[model samples]
Target: MIRITKELSFPLENILFSFALKSEAADVFDGHNTLITGIGKVNAAYELSKAIQHKKPSLIVNLGSAGSNYFQKGDVICCSKFIQRDMDVRGLGFEQYETPLSNLPILLEYGFEMEGLQTGICGTGDNFEMGHNTRIYNVVDMEAYALAMIAMKENIPFLCLKYISDGADDNAADDWMIQVHKAAVAYGNILNLNKNNISI
Candidate 1:
């Protein structure tokens, strides 16, 4: 794991938020620690791997924008389960989205409640094109599962929040590019409700 620690120190449980794009977190957090891990599962895993090992915060939160066919734009959702959408090797008797030989199912679960947010599983991949999964209410993102998996491995309490930016479709790429900034601002304002702003 690459160590990317800040010189500043804080108490335990200091919330560390990871975002794949700055637009997703630029203003979402006031004073809490945040990082732009770039877009895609590889970048997410690589950056987050370093983050957790270096800081070792009590909790990890991944906040970002997603495109969904079922969810409407601007709706904040809690990512309760994570599935690696591209992990398919059923030909060899592995289950869909199942991590091979690791006993770690590609489907990872984390349940945490927040008001006005729907709980949904996030299907993660490096590709932005939308596709199918066993889950019904799912969010399409490029980074959530990788971050969640790392968080799980490190035994840190984790939560993922997403704001739907577009319907996953031919227009999704363009729409997401335009909507993410506004979504970030809205998410940041929502954080105001946290008061202490660092709940698990």
Candidate 2:
């Protein structure tokens, strides 16, 4: 088991890097313990949560590609807060995205900082939502919310980093495919910069 302390200077080896797709992490993080969690929230939540329970890394760093109308293509942003955009059960006297009974029902936050990375609000859904957006969330993804929520429940420090691959337009698929590799490389740079942040 890994211990969480006030000091934030752990070796990169103790950090578990996660990716939704292998190609999204290709040529990057070649020698690290990166988790390729398939795609979407179910895969990420089940796999990552299981791993966290078993291995208990000091930190989890989720890196992948995302769609955005505001963030520039190839821009890597840190997800400090996450929300589930696809959950709509307001008819039952609850908010649309609220994860019922949780302390922070609709939102989960990762309390940490990374130098040279801008904190962004990320929204996750099962489907790839194109052109559907809100001003509150700049990044749209498929896995970050589930990953962050699980980490919070497990009391593990989590950081989500994403590269903007598309503009939430019709051309998003093609753009995502083309830019996934680039995003992977950029994610590597962040790991190198903050290698000591993960607890050894």
Q: Point to the candidate with the largest lDDT.
A: 2
**Model 1: lDDT of residue 181:** 85
> Can you write out model 2's per-residue Cα lDDT over 1-200, one digit (the tens) per residue?
12223445556667788899998878556666789999899999999977887778888988899999888998888788888988877888888888667667576676565666777889899988777558767899999998887888888888788899998788888888788778876865655533333322
Q: Worst lDDT window (10 residues) for model 2?
A: 191-200
Model 2 lDDT, full chain set: 0.79
Query: What's model 2's TM-score?
Result: 0.88
lDDT of 2 at 16: 88
Measured against the true structure, the TM-scores of the candidates, in listed sequence, are: 0.83, 0.88
Write down the RMSD of all candidates, one decimal each. Answer: 6.4, 3.9
Cα deviation at 111, candidate 1, in Å, is 4.4
Q: Where does candidate 2 clash, by residue pair?
A: 10-198
> Cα lDDT for residue 72, model 2?
91
